[model samples]
Target: MAIVKLSTTERRRLSVFFTCLGLAIVAWIFTTLSSPLPFIINEALVYKNSPQKKAFHPLQADTIKITIQGTGWQMLFSKMKPDSKPITVDLTPLESRNYVVLSSQLKLINAKRDANQQITAIDPDTLYFDFTNRLTKKVPVRALLGIDYQKQFAISGNVSIKPAYVTVSGPADRLQKIDEWKTDSIKASNVNESIATRINLQPVTEGNLTIYPKSVQVNIPVDEFTEKTLDIPVKLINNHNYDNVKVFPQKVKVTFTTSLSRYKDMSDDLFEATADLDLWRDHGYSTLPVQLTRFPPFCKIVKVSPANIDFIIKK
Candidate 1:
């Protein structure tokens, strides 16, 4: 095939035509993307201004479809990076009515949003709720703990939580089942010292339920424990016969574990040991078992020497 060479004038004309075509295409694309458009996206719902006297449960899902008006670039970016914040819905109207209209609150809701992206409409414009008898009760607060204490060190006393009870209000059916509300876990490792801090209560997942005072103050006492031995006098009880009844040993050695702070205060007077005489009368038992009737709190009993005592009944 014979090659055809273009003249200098022809080559210049062809280059100018292609350049103008490229610029026109670029301008057209830019103008199209800059125009405002509407797009629909889903947003979670958060309720506020709830009525104190009424208990309400949503009849529909907790999500709403929101239509926003913005430029094509904003719409594309919104699709790529979605908004995670839930839309706050005012439930003040529910005091007199059982339903709320989302369109009525559009002006108030748009105040917090960016001016570039305005919400135009919402699907399911009317949100309805089912009403039931509201019930409020004071329930105990239980703390969940995970602690790793150092050797010879542990919790010395009972874990105390301020305002041990919290007020919970919800539908009667749900409130009746909740006897106690637990706080989030309190975890610690190498817990050699006492813990005094505030912890958050478990969050309410059901929108119908509400708990006052979301957090509580906790105080955990910690100390080192040591072994303590005491010689407690044994008492004879149920001496019905008009005769002398005596136990072979008047005192028995008792070993226990107690906190170091209270070690010096420990004494045999705080404990009581008894050997029941009825054991010999009721059953033909040869020996009476020594029983510890009382002891101080927070003390772990290790061993009670001479568990069984020999008794003599002289009639």
Candidate 2:
């Protein structure tokens, strides 16, 4: 094809038209992508892969105000949120604080965001971590448990926790006074059956503290109790005038309850029933209260038949 050259005025007019067309395209793009939209993501910052020798503290809790831009449809339907996991911020880049800029970690933060969304600005643009030497300590674990059984039910044995101690590693000063860590509240109500469950260790507010065993298994022994009766002789003591007074009944029935495991261990020999003569009256016959001086361990005294014994005064 042969080229036909136009005059300078015609060419100028054509160049102007092309320039206007180019400006129109650029204006369309600027309107579509340049206007910043504010999207505030709250409580979404996470730290990972920090230096093993150094510990970081007071992780930033401020909201991430990401001023982003996208096509109208992209901004309308697709939510633009940032995840900080992929962001690798070297806190000890130069073994000094000056290396990382104080004003903005956005470049480090931007690496974590979705690629399609364009970020124009971020608010509170600076975050600096306070670093300290990592610390490790072995602390004991205490359980926090409460139980209320149904009527006539009780615990058979002590509550037991597996792995009574845990390793807590964090900043030295923070872990220095923490001799023990307690588990979260494990409350069971109206519980007649035995309890066996895994309990989580209560976390401390200290930053960068790691627990070796985050949880432990707790076992509680429970069983329905049984009661038994035994005739125990009442021993009289501390009587000023024993020859002048007499107790009518020589023995009383003592009823007690114990766990099945300890049922066979209880006997009248393990208990001592007694009556005091201090409250005696000069009347022919009077009632005196019977008191237990001793009883078997872990056995509950339910009843003492004939709580009051009749005594006839001879003098």
Candidate 3:
């Protein structure tokens, strides 16, 4: 193979191109390092497992605050693992201080390891958080059912809770009046059938108190009524044995009212009236003797003005 060398002019041109490229790379590096990106605190980070030995309550500011550093676009799209993690702080440590003290320490979140040990990097390694010890107090649990109905109806059953109480933990101002909690009124008219509804736990005074059971299950009994009319049949006593004997006013006038609840099981043939045939047989002998028949169930024979009537015997 034969080798050829470039001319002096060609070498100089290549040198100039390389110098410009090197300068551009330096400028890019400087710009990237000098500029700071915007970020947001998405959650709190807890460094030690024993930040607070006691259980932590919800909505209570504790051992950590999660600070995320990134461009607006990246922060908006980024998310934290285990979306919700309990951050604890030791209240005993801050007991000496008159006011609550916040710790300046922070922890970085790392990628979780699987059965196969491997190093994984989680984005936004370091996180900043604010910590304050919260006071816990007992509060009454109020049952709430979020339902609205028309008027003329009411709800029944378990208006008061069985274990009608709960515990709350938060700022001192909010925990002062943590004895009771009331829920919004549940409309009765809206109730058609039994229902289970959710209600928010609101503080009587605007404070940072966190309820143990944030929500409660309310059991409401709905009342329903229907209107109906029943037609009861007017019956005649001794109807079969009447043979030649006639009844003046065949139907015994009966007009009464009953409730719709029991009306369905009732029939019209439940009422009847009859004449005393013993009077006729006493006067003279004839066919078999007859008396008033039995009445139907749940029925009354209304106003038999002339209950007894004379029956003429046919020779």
Which candidate comes out best when scored by TM-score? 1
In model 2, the worst 10-residue window by lDDT is: 81-90
Identify the runs in model 3 with alpha carbons over 4 angstroms from their true place. Answer: 1-72, 75-105, 108-138, 150-153, 156-158, 169-173, 182-190, 196-217, 225-315
TM-scores for candidates 1 onward, in order: 0.67, 0.52, 0.33
So what's the TM-score on candidate 2? 0.52
Per-residue CA lDDT of model 2 for 1-315, tens digit only, reads 999999999999999999999999989876865465544332334444445666666546534555555555455444553343322344444245523432355665656567756466654455556667888888778889788898767887777888878988778778887899999988999988889999999965443567779899888888778998999999876676655657768899999888777788777899999987766634433688899999876678889989999876675
Instruction: List the global CA lDDT of all models.
Output: 0.91, 0.71, 0.45
Better of 1 and 2 by TM-score: 1
On residues 63-158, what C-alpha lDDT tens digit does candidate 1 reach at each position? 999988988888788789986668899999999999999999999999988898689999999999999988898999999999899988889989
**Candidate 1 segments exceeding 4 Å error:** 1-46, 59-90, 100-127, 133-135, 238-243
* Model 2, runs deviating above 4 Å: 1-36, 39-45, 59-124, 129-133, 146-151, 185-192, 228-256, 267-315
